[model samples]
Structures are given as C-alpha cells and as structure tokens.
Target: MAQAGEQAVGIDFGTSTSLLAVGSGVGPVDIAPLGRTTRSFPSIAGYQQGNLLVGEAAENLPIAQVIRSVKRAITDCSETMEISDEHGTRRVDVDEVIVALLAEIGTRAKAAGRPLDTREQVRLGCPAMWDGAQRQRLLDHAQNAGLPVAHSTLIDEPIAAGVAWVRHRYLQYGEQVEGRLLVFDMGGGTLDIAVLDVVGGPHPEISVLSALGVQLAGDRLDTAIAGEITEELAGQGIRLDGLPEAKTVEALVLREARTAKIQLTTQARHRIVFRGLARTQLPILTYTREQLEECFRPQMDQAIGLVWAALRAAKLTELGGHAPDKLRGMNGDRLAADIDYVLLAGGMSRVPYVERRIGELFPNAMIYDAAGVAADELIVAGLADPVGYDRLNLHRPGFDFVLEYTESGRKITEKIYPAYTPFYSPEEAWTNSYLGFERRGDDFPGPKRGEGVLRVRSTSGDYLALRYDGETKHGLRLQLGWNMLFKIYCDGQILITDGARQTRKLRVHQWPVVRGNGHAELVLQRVDDAPPVPSTAWYLEKEYAPPGL
Candidate 1:
C-alpha cells in the first residue's frame, strides 16, 4: 500500500535504456516522459563543462567522454570508467554515473506531473542472473539517488516482464489468463528466461518454476555487427588500425551499428553513416535485415539453447529430480509441449528474426510479441500494477546445495537440496536424509574424540565448513532442512534419538561483498581459530538417497 499523495513507481534500470512509470494506485500506469519526446532515458552519462550530464544530454557528448551501458558495466563488476575529454582524463565511479542517471529520471518524472515521493512504493528490476550482491547494489544506488526502495522491492527483470504480459492479456481479453508461460527477455546486456505457472481467478497466483539468464543480448549483437563492419572495411583497404582516433572510430561504428539494428527491426534495410570521427568520414553502408539476421543467428541459437536449459530445469523441478538427464522420458519435445504461451519481452525481442525463431521453436505455444506494447514499458507497467504487484510470487534463487566429501580415496559431491526447491514456503520445506558420517576403515575412525569438518557447497561455488566434534562409535546421522525463512540447518545425531547431537544453522552473519551466479553467498565465520580436519569418512547412505544420486 502507498501513502497519501503518493504514486507507486516502477523503474526499469536497463543496460541500454532506463524507463520509469508511475501510477496513482487506481488507474493504469503511465510511462513517464523522460525527455520531451522520448519515454526512455539512455542508460548513459558524461561530464560536460565540469558538470554531469545524463541521458540524451550525455549522448550529445563525444563518445570518449560519455559512458554508455553503465548498467552492463555494473553487472560486470566494473567500478570506474575513464572519461577523456578536452579537460583531460578523469576517473569516474560507475556508481556515481548510475546515481546521476537515476536522479535525472526522478527529475524528469517530476516534470511529467508525477512527482516521486519517498513514501511511495518503488520497485526496481534486475537481471535474473544477478545474485544477492548485485541486487543489493542496485537497491543501494536507487536509494542513493533519492528513490524509496528496499531489497525486497527488487524484482527479476523477466518476472516483471511476465507480470506485464499477464496483465496485458487480462486487460485485453477481459478475462483472467491461466497457463504455463515462458518469458524470454533479451535486453541490451543479458538474456533472461523465466518459466512460470499462473493461476487465474479473482485473485491471480503466479508461481515461477525456473529462471535462468546469460550475458548475451542486444549489446553482443551490436558488437558482432560492428566487428563485421570492421572486417569489411579492412577488406576494402580502409584501415583505421593505425589511425590516431581508432578507439573513437570504433565507438562510432558501434553506435551506428546499434542504430542500424534498431531501424532494421521495422525496415528491411537501414543506411548507416559514421560522421565526426578524428578527421576521417567513413562511407555510408546499407545494412539489410538479412545481414542483421546473419549477425544474430549464432547468438539466437545460444539464446534458444538457454531457453531449453531453463525448460529442462523447470521439468526437473516438476519431476522432483536433481538433474535433467536423470529424469526418465524427459525430452525437448515434451518440454516444448508443456509450454502454453511464450512472451517475448525487452528491446531485443522487437527483432522480427528473433520472433520468428521463437515461433518456430515453440510452434504449439501461443507467441506474444512485445510489439503490441512497447518493450521498454513492460517492466515499469508491471511494477506499478496494484493487482499483479500484490499477487505476484517471484521465484526464489535457483541454486543447489551440495555436500562435498572424500569417500574411498575419491571426491564425492552430493546435492543436498536441488535447485528450485520451495525453501521459502513453509508447506513446501524440504528435508534430505542422505548425509551421514561413518567409520569406513581403520584409517578413518569417524571423528573419534576429535573435530571434523563437513564441507557444505553451493552450485555457485560458495561453501561453508560445518565442524562436528563428538565421539561416535557407530556413526553420525545428519539431516539437512531448509525452513520458511530462508535458513538452512544441519542436525547431526549419533544414530540415536536421545544420543549426543549437534545442530548447526548456517546464517548470514554479514552481507559479503561478493558476486555469484544468481545464488546467495553463504557466509559463516569459523567458531574457532583451529584448522578444520576434513571429514573424509562421511558418505551418503544408499537407502536414504534421493533421485540422481
């Protein structure tokens, strides 16, 4: 719920462009005009005349002075950008640039008659592959830019796009839509895919089955097209390699390639011209849809592969397995058949070739292109929607908890909690009994009168060492469980209900400034300064093993 005189705000802080929308908690969300005639503000900024400029104003600066795709740089762990201009080179913090751009967005929103209030609820969108660290970074930046938002207010970009699609269909048909939906969001920096199950009624319920993302999208395509143009120029003996402003020329070529790419979405061909380079004017070139398709095919194939991977992950979730190949009778065709609708979103989704390829892949599923509603507006609209905003059930982190130990002179990794497990739902809390520490041979006495370490690992390479100190004659039976509050506990017993047992829960002591593959980093401090002895005697009992053991 929003406060009085407050409008809900949704900010899609995208890689290439950022958009803002505001609603009065009653009517449809209105896309705020960032500029006089543009709804989107370029995700770029620069310093001109010793003052910071953002969006279109920054676009007017020299390519070397301007920083483009700041969102992508943030995701890639970039901390600073060097802007070289007539005033000389100066190092600028990436966070400062992001905050400046966001502040400008807020300024424009106010000018559009939708003044952003700190009491109003604000939702920000991030790529699906971004882990907790990245999400928190964005939240901090937003708050620094005077936006009222928290970590809980951050939503996955693809999930927000899905909500937008669901809302659009519900409004268009005047009926609630229910089915399995696959949202493909190919933005400038990343391609995010989400498979969701929607239950339509007076109160809609949306559940995300699986979600995945890759760092391949419109920017990569732009780079590919630019590379092709460079090669063509090289073949024509028009070499810019030894030129004084090679970097400037390269930047100009990339900008033109991006413009051509956007124009080719509507027209079959686009004419690109590179001007204002360091004393040399490159010839105008004609870029056709076919040529664009050629540049996009390989990346599209990779994106399609990621879609299949996401589908397989979803199927694994439905089938209650740790791996896709371990599930019986599972294939691509079955996965494709299970999808009821495919929602294309993001700026890259506007490409006709991308739409056609998706249609061909999922022939049976109904395809909803973003052309009907502008791609840039989808996330913000969904964020501001009161109905969908309240009912949306965003998917939790998709990461597997694994236990690694040495058994019989070989290293073994056992998945304790499979990916997509509903750890946040009390009714869906899962328990695994596959963890055990026993006396294997004379070499291993099962932590007899000494402490041993049980290494707990995550799919994202985060790990924790659980120390077990006790004297067990027979063995130690370990049970791992995840509660509704996103907490994981490991209870170790001496094979007797009333016997000596140690229960340890790994909780985040402090938020670590580390990044991972969409997985929360498990940070825990050692109880003692002593070195932990690796528990090589631990093994998983076959009787209690889950599928894909």
Candidate 2:
C-alpha cells in the first residue's frame, strides 16, 4: 500500500500525443485535462517570431515551422531539426525541442491542479525497443523539465498497459483474476507486444514472459494511404511535381489521409476536401473502408507476422534454447490456446481491421478492452496505480552479454549472461568464470608484456574495454552480477589474499536494432598505466526510490 499523502503520477509522453494521470493512496486514478475539453496535448512544437508554441497552439503552424513526433529523435542524440518563421530560420537540437515540450506539459498539468512536485512519485513510459542510452536520454529530459522521475521509475509502454488491464480486472471481480494476457500496443510510431502471466489474489503477481517491438504503426499506415492518394491525383492530371508549393501540397495530402484513416475506423466512408491548390480546384475525394483496407493489407500482414514472431520468441525462451532450429517442431495451436486474453492498446488498435485479424489469430483468446477506458489512456492509468508498482516483473533483456578477448592468435567470445534470464531473481544474480592470461606459445603473442585488454560487449552493440596488468602469473577470477537496479558489474581478482582487484560496473543496453553498426564503445581513461574502475553505489535513497518504496 502507498503511504498517506503520497501521490503517483504517470506521464505518457507519446509520439502522437501526451497525457497525464494522478492517483493518491488507494483511490482511482484521474486523467488531468490539458485543455478546456481534451485530456491530451498534441506532441508537437512550433517556432514563431523567436518564441516557441507547443501542443494545440503549434498544431496550426505551417508544416515547415512545426516539428511533429519529436519523441522519435531521442534514439539519435545528434539529430537536429530546422524550423523557419517570418523572422528567420534556425537549426535546433532535437533534445532541446523535447525538453521544451516536456516543460510545457509540466506547466499545463500544474495549471490543472496536478503539479508534478519532487515529493510525488512519478513514472514515465518508453518503447520496449529502446536501449539504455535512449532511456537515459529521456530520463534526463524529464529531469530538466522539472518532473519527479528517475531510472527506476521508467516503465515499458506495453507492460504499463498490461498493468492497467490487471488492475481493471481486479476491480471488476472484487478479487484477483488470474490468466495469461497478450498486450498488443500499436501507437503512432511503434508497435510493442508483451506476453504477461498473472496470478490473481489480494496481492496479484504479473510476470512479463517476453516483449518485442518494431517501428511500424499508425504513422506508416498513414504514409501508405497518402501514397495511394497521390497516385489517384496523378491519374486525374493533377501532377504535384515541379510545383512551387509541392512540399506544402504533400503535407496537406498526408494530413487529410490521417484524418480519413481515423474516420474510417468507425465509418464506412469519408470525404476528404482538398482546397487552396495553386490555380487548381480539385473535386472532393471520397475514400471508403475497402480502399483503406487495400492500402493496409501489406502493413497489416507484416504486423500480424510480428505477433507470431513475438509468441515464438516467448516459446523458445521458455524451452531454454537459442538455436533457430529449436522451433522446428513447435506450432501456433499450442501457443494460441495458452493465451486466455488478448488486450488491445494504443490509438492504432482501434482500427476494426486490427481487432478482426487479432481475433482470427488467437481463436480461443478473448479480445478485451475495458468498457469506458480509452486506448490512449491505458498506459497512464496503469502507471498511476500503486497496485502494479511493486508486483510487475518486467521481461528479461533479449540479448546476451559477452566477454571478447584474443587467445592464441584467435578471438574468443564467451557469454557471461544469456538472454531471457530473470534479471531480478536472486538465484541468477551472480555469474562466475575464469579469465586465462597464459602465453602458451610464441603464436599466442598476448597484449604487451605488462598490459592486457579485455572487451565486455552486449549483443546490442554497446561495449567497454578493461586494461589491466598482465604480470600476474595466476589467471584472474571474473565475477559478473546483475544488480537490483538493472545494472551489470564485473569484479576481477587474482587468487590470493593480498592480490590487487579491479571492479567495473557496466550499464546494460538492449534493443531490436544494432546501434551504430557495433561502434558504440565506452572508453575508459587510463590512470597510472591502468584503467580506473570506479565503484558505483547500489542503494537507492528515499526520494529516488521506485514505486512501492
């Protein structure tokens, strides 16, 4: 239970929109209104006359002056955007734009009587495919915006949605209801899927078996539909090529395509009006659900294929095998039968095609969406609830941590920790291995007579090198441990009482893509001819503690 006077705030800083929710003690969470009648703020920012406008104010700005989907740039720290106004044109760092948007959100939430003070518990949701560097960048941005957030408070978006479902079920049944749930979250920029196993009772337990994501969602679908519209215009002798306002016309078409897509979700047909074309008066374009489905078929097929991939990942991990051939005998029937419920989340999940296809894939699973809960608010609702703050076990990292070094003129790679292992379980905390430094023959040609280099690498492409003295006759005993705060540390020591020991902590990085073509290396400074290994404190203070503290 949460302490009295304590508040839990969940901020869903999404690519299309941002939302805020607050919960106190055991009460139901409430979504704070950012405008007179809307609870969401558009995730966009615009520059005008040396001033910045955010949310609804920025939505009306010219496409060239406004930056949409600013959250997607966090993956690349060096990304920049150019925005021009009547005054002049300037280039701005993407991080700066994100910070401004977050600060504005904080201001609006405060004006709505839900200020995010340092004393209140706050959590931010991120895409499941984000690596440690991306996550850290978001945490820093939230801090700069004056939000009460820390590393431990960051929750995966799909997992947060699952938490919302679990809490809603608990309330509906007046008791805990146990089952297996598969959460499908397809938002503006990405599609995240998580398989969760739940045990219901007064104290519910939720474990994420596997999680996966891909950069395919509502935004891509809009682009496809817009392309189809462009073809139609080209056939009508309305060519936009070489036109003065070509970019503007393209943007207008995309905007109309997005609007039409949303309308087609609940309507059979929608009419898109195109006005202000240079010297051309075009006829009103009518788009139907059938045409939309034609444009969506390829993307929808890929999306459903990804769902099967996620389920296969979970099954293979449960079987404790890493080889691809391990799944030769497995089929979809057993996996589909195991899923008791399929929870749809995110704005894209509202599409009727998505629901119908998912229902076909999981024949025996119940497709669930809480009666009154909006798809966009699911993540925030779960984030604000204290019930899942302490009981939800996140999915283990999907990549392995390895040690790479040269031995006898050959490169040797040893796995220190395998993927899909419980990160928080005490039984899997410590991993022990031996680091041999023997120069068996001249062919071995080890590092220098007094120096050696050992590189610790994660499959996701982040690595750190350790330089140590090679004079010790006995090999070093290497111990790697996953700490409670989701960090990995390495301790190397000679087998003697007074032997010198070196300890280094490496932050774990995981992602679906290989970052920078495996060039993301952490360089350590050398001190007195040896690399310095600083010890980090593993304890959390009262204010920095995670939820349920």
Candidate 3:
C-alpha cells in the first residue's frame, strides 16, 4: 500500500503472473498485492457467462476461452486469434487482449488501494528486444484501455530487474555498490539477459551496456517434462485421443508438470498423480529432480550460450594483459572477473539446479539470488525520483530515429541513432556525433543541452518530407521566406505568428532522444501563396524533449 501524496506505481505485467509496486518521491517502494496472494496475480483473462474476469479470478476458466501470455503474443507481432465461447467465435487482436488485461489490472490495483490516476507516474515494463513499432502499439493499446498513463514509458525487462536489485542492496546495506552487473531474468515464458553498470549514490545511476533475449523459457521446459510423463502413461492402459480430449489431458499434464518443476527445487522427487484426466484413470507418476534438470538442460545450455554471446559482444571476455594461449577454454568466472555481481530475477531463478549452474559460471562474483526481486518491481523503483523521478532522467528509449527523404527521384533512408550507441539520458550532451563504432575517442561529454543544424538544399525537387519510423509526440513545421525569415533557435522556444505572438504547448518526442542525431530535414521551395499563419509550410523539424516535464 502507498501513502497518499503523488504515488508512483510500477506494474510488472508478466507472462504467467503480474505485480504492482507503489512508492512516494522519497520513501521505500511497497508491494501492492492482489487480494490475499501477496504481490502475485495471474496474468490471465477469461470470459465466462456474460462476465469478463482477470487475474486469480480468471485462472480456473476453460483453456479455450482463457487468454494467457498475451505479452508474448503481442511481441510476436500477431494481429488476432479466433476464440469460441458462449458468445460465438470472434477474432480478437493481440492488442485488444493486452488492453483488456491492463484494464483489469488497473481496476484491481485501484480496488487494492493503490490509485494510478496519474498516467504520467506509472511505468510499464516491456521486452528488451521489442522494436519501435511494437513499443508504440503497446502505448496505443494502454491508452485505449483507459489507463491514465500520460507519463508512462516502456522499460526493458532485465533493466527493470536490475534496478530493483540495486535498490534492495542499497536499502539493506546503506552503502552503494559500484561495479558492473550481469542481470539474468528467466521468467515463465521468456528469458532476458542484460549487462548493466551500476553506480551507487544518494541518486543511483544505472547504464545498460548490452542485452539479449530468447522466447523459450519455463513453458517449454514444462512441455518437455510433460511429454515424458505422457509417454509413460501411453505405455500403460490409459491414453488420450482426439483434439478436445488430448488438449484437456495436455493441459492437465502441463499443470502437473509446472507443479513438479517447482517442487523439484526443494525435494529430490515429485509425484505426478492424475486420476480423471480425459475421463481416464492414470497410474501414479513420479519424477526426480535430476530428471527435471535433464528436461531443462537444453534450455539452460541455450541460456549459457546467450550469456556468453552477450559477454563477448560487451568485450568482457577480453583478457587485456593476459596471454592469448590462456583464453582457449575460458569460463564465465574468468571472463566476467570484473563484474561485481551476477543478479538473477524472475521465478525460474528459484530452481536449485538453475542457481547451481549460474553459481558455477560466476564463481568469483557474488550472485544476487533474486529472492528480493522475483516480481520485477525494481524497474518502477528505479524510475522513482526523490529529486525528479517523472523527468526523463531514467528509462531507456526503444526506437531509432530514421531520417528519410527523396533524392534523384529515389527514396533514401538514413539511420540517425545507430544501434551501437549505448543508452543515455535525454539531457546528456553529444560529442563527435556519438557514431557508435565510428567514435574517435573515449570522451563522453556530460549532461548538457545540444543542438544540430539541418541544411535543406533544393537540388532538383520541390517536395520533401521528414518521417520517423517510430512513435512521435508532436511535429513542428517552420518556413523561412525572403520577406519574413522564419528563424528557429537552438532553444526549443518557437516564435510563430498565427495572428499574435504566443507560445503553444509543445510535445517533443519521447524521452532520451539521441542528441548526436538531433536534426530535421525538409525542402525549400517557393509556393504560389504560402500562408503566413503557422500552417501551409514546405516541411518541418521534429524534436524530442525530455518527457514528464
């Protein structure tokens, strides 16, 4: 529960479950639980009879009608899926399902006593690998769902987890831990890994060095283990047949396998007994922790491969002064000697085998066991600012600003913010264009305002348009004619004459706009009667201001 004044709510809408956390500007972040289940809520929605239900209330619905893992569905860029129920079959877009789920969460949160009335104060977490279009679609859906998220921004899943990890350490130790960290987040449906550099202080600073994600996780593990159970049952007298019957049996096996997976964390073996699956009796089944580990071995190997790949990409594997011959069979302990902590987040981290493998890899570093960050409330905690949390000082942007126009009667596209440029604050100054690998030196100009000029030359055409392939806040158009020269200054203040001199409310694009690529393109051509008012111009320059001002 949150104390009254201007509460900042952070929602971890997971694939299998969701959680909400609330905090004021300068206090400890509190977990807002759903009913009596502490902080966890089933990330499921169902339509039964004439009523729609979500979270725990919707968990027991028929599989055909229940929408689960809608986050992953939307991330796949899917449009819709047809589901039949008492209301008949109809197509529902992934976005619509996500909206419904979020709306339900909103209602539940309010009823639970954490008011998220201010849109700007809410932070939502998204997958790390999502592109610009996906991020925008989510925002659009959230808005349409009637979520007041005026100041809402998307956070990378792993980054959010890292933020929580650091905060917990700070509160417990009263000392800021400074060093690099490798965040491994293995949830029910997805695994996201990111390397972040943490700087502890009264105001902590976290920088994401690199990240990677995979679609396979606990769901796949559960299926693989369930397959083994079904094979054993098929060997006996009882066996499931037909689509409907098989699905029912499959669902039951999955549920049991999931339970076994959790039980294997503590006990040596777990029994999988099903009596009425598909209306058939089954012999009691038992699986040991070793067998369950075997089921997840392949996925664990994949997770290892991803971790190695990320470390290699981040250059952590480079033994600067060591001999080349010694690098032959380098393991994680040697490769990540500089990393102070290996933090684990997500429910799957609770598995003893999973922890053992991660421990083997980071033998030299203290691995944060993720008991404190299991629900991923850290992302919103990181967004909280006792000083100025709502301001765009935190949170990474997920889009690349692309400058596109026509040249020689052919369209050309240029990537302004190259992918290699590390995540930076919106107010950070730009030096040497921050050209990713093309950077000449290691000097990074600190936080300061920056400006760039776009020279529009009318070589042979009179039509030019500026476009960004990602979501935009607002667009601005200005024209400089011979008689009345339209002068745009480095400062964001615009001096436009509609009829009188007045400054209209302007919305620059989303936060942390890449400063090096901060310029707009347009065409300079004479029109027959260009209006002197703000409208009717050749083209305009669009800029992104720091959000939540």
Q: TM-score for every candidate vs. truth?
A: 0.74, 0.73, 0.69
Cα lDDT for residue 344, candidate 3: 76
Residue-wise C-alpha lDDT for candidate 2, range 1-549, written one tens digit per residue: 455346789999999899999866355678899754689888988877667788888877876577777887873345787656565567777888899889988999999998898677788999887766777789889999888787557788998888877777766566576788899999998899888888765456787766777778898999999998888888888776655667667777888889999999999999989865665466688899999988888988988767766675555333212333333345777668778889999999888988888889898888886523788788888788665755555455334444444557776665444533332221121121211111111323223233233344444444533333433212223332221111221111111100122333322212221222333233322222345334223422121211111
Report lDDT per candidate. 0.66, 0.66, 0.57
Model 3, C-alpha of 49: deviation from truth (Å):
4.1
In model 2, the worst 10-residue window by lDDT is 490-499
Predicted candidate 1 versus true structure: per-residue lDDT over 403-429, tens digit per residue: 444556665665544433333221112
List candidate 2 stretches off by more than 4 Å: 1-6, 25-27, 75-78, 82-91, 276-280, 319-323, 397-549
Q: Which should have the higher lDDT, number 2 or number 3?
A: 2
Clashes (backbone N, CA, C under 3 Å), per candidate, total: 0, 0, 6
lDDT of 3 by residue, 475-527 (tens): 23222122211222111111222112212222212223121233233212212
